[model samples]
Target: MTTLEQLLDLPRFSDLEILSAHKNLERKVESVEITETPDVANFIPKNAIVLTTAMIYKDDQSKMKHLLDTLVSKDVAALGIKVGRFIDDIDQDVVDYASKVDVPIVKVPSSQPLGRLLYQMLSYIWDAKTEQLTYALDIQKRFSGLLMHDVNLSRFIAELGKIINAPVILLSPWHKVISNSQYFSRSDHPASFYIEQIDDHHYDKINEGNSSFIVKDLKGENVQVLGYPVNVDTYFPFHLIILKPEQIPYPVSEFAIEQAILVLTFILFKNYKVDEFFDIMKSDFLSQLIKAKTDQTHDHRNWVDLGSRYGLVHSKYYRLALAYCVPNKDNKTKLIYRQEEAAIAKKWLEAQLPLRIKNVIIFKVKNTNEIALLFQSQEPDANKVLQTLADELKEALSIQLCFAFGNPYEAITNISSSFIEAKSALDEATRLFNPNVVNYYHPKGLVGLFENTNEESIHYYCEKILKDLAYPNDQSQKELRNTLKHYLDYNCEITKTATALYLHRNTIKYRIKQCEKLLGLSVKDPENSLNLRLALELSESGNESSEQAEPGA
Candidate 1:
């Protein structure tokens, strides 16, 4: 860290004068060399100050110019000449050339020996190096002590910020804030400003290159951010970042950030593995509970014992719900069901659920895009809690989720019945083309009534009841069929039907009249309306089944 300007201030070299290139005195001097040979430039080290008498170039001004040019090309820090010895004074041409090229030239008097000057410069360098080494070792000890203690992730980040004297942030793969230091709150801008300024595209390049890089003044402020990737061997790893002010001339030490990344990688990876281990255990427990036989040989008490670990208790009413990822408008099915996102979704659900519904177990189904939940149904507000959870998850996941829950049962052995009912409700909702909504299993609903009926018989009954609407031949007939279906779904309320279908009330009345004319029956009659609703539902269900049963479906 010794500069040529600082060397001039030494006690032994206080009389040295700068002959040229005054602005270049700030260049660093890492070492010093004493050489009088003509070709010293070929072997002199870089960032070094060369001490010479200029005896070889005293007779030729061009040779002196060549020497200065060669020294500049080799990145020599400075040149000190022994004045009033072999050369009384430097040539004007040589001084001008050195100054023009920004090469520092120092004049040394005859009383000052080149050997003593070299010694002084090297001693300064050694002292600087020693100080740097001590600083690095201190940083190592402090950061290393963090691991010896059982500190959480937030505490670790806070300590890291204290060591570096800058704001630190730990980010997930999606650029969400996993944790941040207290210094972040004292910044001129909020955490969201920096998070938004994080260039994902730049991070992608850094990730691909597998190196640490800096981004200058992210939002046109005097702040530079350093992004260091942790656990690069994994599929998606966390990014450790530091925000430093621009007034600080030098960046934070590389050894400091490296030590932080090392300890943080260990902490984060350990937590991830622990979470993964518990997920496997929970999944196995649920699998065993659902697949267990309720025969006389198998004791039901053992089931309750195993379920107790996951908040499932004996004699508690529980409902089984199954959720599936529904396709979005952009056809993001390919991005859905990734193991990482599913894990995140599970954590979000666990943290966001209401405290009243505490006895809940959730796990991702094996080899499928489904999540299974088994929770107690003791509270009257449990349904409302589930609906709120579903809405939040759907928005948070950036994809649609359809949930179907079966009726509650008190016995652990009856979990299999609940699972079956949930599956049946999901399948029925899918057939009705309304699979994105939350569905509850009702044993006396229309779907449950016709669950065991033959597909051909259902199709025949549907066609017999609604003659032409069953298979529309034109757009007008299609609109009439859709309007009639919505009318019945809204309980024949013209206002609700219009709002649901986004149509005028008069249009709905006209469609109902047209349907009455075509079917030769009064839709206002209770029996006729009931039959029409049944036929419409059965027709839609049969068509959906037929399409799915096709070869390419």
Candidate 2:
């Protein structure tokens, strides 16, 4: 608690004094006020010691009476009269009128300057304020440990508010109320209320270079509002601070407020660090789990945590996906900028998607130009999302993407299967169809037919089919390749193959005979024809180019 003696000791009031003559009268001074007009009575602040000179109505008795009437109406604490050159003697009429009105008038002599008296009063008020602030600071320091113990903001703010004898409210940058001390009447409002207050125009004032303080008069309220900018960082999406009384007689300890704000800022930052630590733990755990389940080696396959690569873990959902960029034409060049491209793709996706899609994770798989994403979604539209991602990659990166979407599995255990399916679908897309965009469920129709075919058998059959078509002449080789493709395609039916190839039935029969002679195989036998046809299909599909060498070459 601040004492009156402490208030008098403030340096700001070092030069002024309360007249002993007036002090001896045994009158109480409740509050302090400063004004210029003689009509001070009309606007005398409540419980205030009115400070003014009679210069405004030195000769007018009616004006003095009106002023006295106003002061009486306001229930002023006392009247302070500054008597300098303007009033050489205490006006008998004024003193008589004031006495009649029962308004105590303290004479301020010419020898004692009005400025010095005002300064003394101000100093006294400030000294008391400083003492109160010192007490608050002491309380804050003592309670610092409690604050550090993860106490909710409301409790902390309430304690601070009690010490200051003022209401305290916490607000985000958008003016959303977080918590309030006991003094505030209301504690809750619509979320949109806060959002509406955070206008872009105000950002400059709040987020300008470093820290700032401003006093504003809210249009509807008579209370003076002071705003303090909480300095975290440029990218800190939210700003937080407390609001309290603006200009009460209670001294504001700027230092105490600064220290309190610093402590709060530290708490917020610490929370962020803890969150980040947990997110990294979660991401690493998931990545390792997938890696273990797949038995992925360092060379052949690996999982990547996209969330960590691009700060996606800071978002509400921790999600990502993976896409592989396989080489064509037997080239082994690794995909360059796979991670960088994924980041770019992620940004593009963000632009295209609705603002509600706040969290997206992306990363590049090791040893492969495969981008992985852990998409975070509350309710996902998989097809639309996939198409959007594919379109963006195609348009911006110009790189065809094979998106392997994992199930929206909440746990690490189920993710591996989704990942495997996506990878299989991606591989099939690269091998049998366009690599631009493919989903795991897309090639379901072909899964049944190709399920039993081994990699080696498929390679061998494709090689043999191409080998039988290698003719001595380029034109004849082309002709034979076309003929074999049609014959195998038509299930070895001479009529259908001939018709499909736009040739006479005899011509097709002759080509088959020629093919049988060259390959030394029975083209008419079912078992032999199946082998030939399988080989033809693989060779035509271009998977056996390296194995199927040209004849005589």
Candidate 3:
């Protein structure tokens, strides 16, 4: 992992001058190899620093040009040539091309033997490799001792950063943060957001054979992310990311990451049975909570054990937050993909919830495309925590989600009430304003009011209000009535109705007047418009026997 620049900075080579430098000085040297002959097609090891006398190409310019092109195409680290041997000096075109391509050319003093020079470069690289190995071993020992103290994942990952002198982050395959070195804050550019954009195909384009790479931190910054990629099979693909990669010793960091991966895999396997039990508990607890069964009637010990097993610090207050992944029907999502997504989304939230707030338990609602989280948070500004969680869901999974949440409640038996409220909020919000977002229950929402109502009552009410308006037999009149509905919804604003219907303002006004004449309702009056709006809503939605009847029905 020794760089050409580092080699030049050595005391013995301080006088060695760089005649032409490569565009990239950070290219690592694999080894030093001598080009025995000046033939342009000679095999060169990748990332090798090469030494050539160029005695064979003294009289032939094309041969010299070919030689330089061959080295550049072969990905040589840099070239060291004894300038005064047979060729006095290089042509301007060759030097310019070398510099432009980032192939650094070093001019060796005439007295220096090519044999000794190549040996010195090899010695430097070997010594660097040795030092990096020792550093990696020290890092492994430090992390290994943490197992005895029962340190958490956050501290374990943070120590890795301190040892390497780099900002570290651990991420799940879905790009959810597992643990990170607190040395860096995620407020500026979320790494999860960017990494989620790079899928497996993109990885193939950028990653080397060993699944490690130096890619631009998806943040569109000048920073290069050095990542050691590893997938934890069914759970998630994960890896270590080094933010300040300039401080990274590639050999040491990569080696230590290998050790970390091994340790983590072993730890997960050791807890595999407990994890399986927790998965079952998640489903059972979620079902009971949805049914509003508490310690009073059914199994009190079950709830207590569930919370204790998962390390949940429960409080009196509980709120239901759903990370619901509404499928993209246009793209035709498969059933298997949906099921896997539900599970993965569940795991993602489970990992992140513990980080943002205490007293949280997450559940994967079976047969539904949603992950439910019940948080008993003491944080005053907990809505911010919910917003952050919602953002992470979108970034980590790369999907649109409705982060619908309910108001906090005191009793565990009232969980079903909160669940219903949260669901109603999501349904109404999606129907009215935005598609993907956090939605709260609105008492005025059409669905919220009629949640307990049956379809028969709603249809009957709509038929009574606007019988003829409901069935606009004539195409033109039907269009007019439809416009009137939107017009009334927009508070009879001609401009808004026109914009919503993509029609002219005058057309909207004419349509509204036609509707008023037919339905016997004034478009401008609040009283008439409210009744007409309710009728339009009832006609559009199915009937329901709600607690509150439709106005004027």
Per-residue CA lDDT of model 3 for 1-553, tens digit only, reads 6777778888988767788854567777878877757653467778888888777767864455566777877788777777787878876777676787667777777888889888888887888788877876876677678755666678777777776667777766665577787666634566565465555554443234234434455456555566665544533446656666678655664566677766655554445456657777776767776774544566454555555765545568878877666667642357666665666666666766677777777776655777777777656755676667667676645655567777777876667777887877777665643464667665656544765578777777666677676655666655765777677778768787677777777777777777777767676887766767777776664322122211220
Once fitted onto the true fold, the runs of candidate 1 whose alpha carbons sit more than 4 angstroms away are 1-145, 172-178, 182-236, 245-251, 293-297, 302-305, 314-316, 324-337, 354-357, 366-369, 378-402, 424-553
Order of the predicted models by lDDT, top scorer first: 1, 3, 2
What's model 3's overall lDDT? Answer: 0.67
Model 1, position 184, has a per-residue lDDT of 66
lDDT of 1 at 295: 49
lDDT top scorer: 1
Top-TM-score candidate index = 3
Model 2, residue 263: distance off in Å is 1.0
Candidate 2 per-residue lDDT, tens place, 1-553, comes to: 2333343455754443443222223233445777778665565456567777777666664566677678877766566777766666566766777777776666666676666676666665566566867865786685577566877667767766765565555654334566666755553443233334444445455555323343323344333334455654333223443343443234446556656666666665676577446645655655665666546453332233443454433323333456654334433343334443443444344445444344554444444446566565554565566676566556433545566555456543445665665666666666764554646434454334565588676666555654646322365656666777677777778887765666777777777787778788787788877767656654455422322322320
Off by over 4 Å in 2: 1-140, 163-178, 183-195, 209-219, 222-225, 229-234, 241-244, 247-249, 296-414, 420-496, 504-553
Clashes of each: 0, 17, 9
Instruction: Give all candidates' CA lDDT scores.
Output: 0.73, 0.56, 0.67
Per-residue lDDT of model 1, residues 145-205, tens digit only: 8667768889999877776777888886555688888986776665656766667565776
Q: How many Å off is the CA of 15 in candidate 3?
A: 8.0
Per-residue error for 534 in candidate 2, Å, reads 12
Q: Rank the candidates by TM-score, best first.
A: 3, 1, 2
Task: Please give the distance, in angstroms, between residue 416's alpha carbon in candidate 1 and its true position after superposition.
Answer: 2.1
Which scores higher on TM-score, 2 or 3? 3
| Candidate 3 ranges with C-alpha deviation above 4 Å | 9-17, 21-27, 36-43, 73-75, 82-88, 108-116, 167-230, 233-254, 257-276, 286-324, 328-340, 347-361, 366-392, 402-553
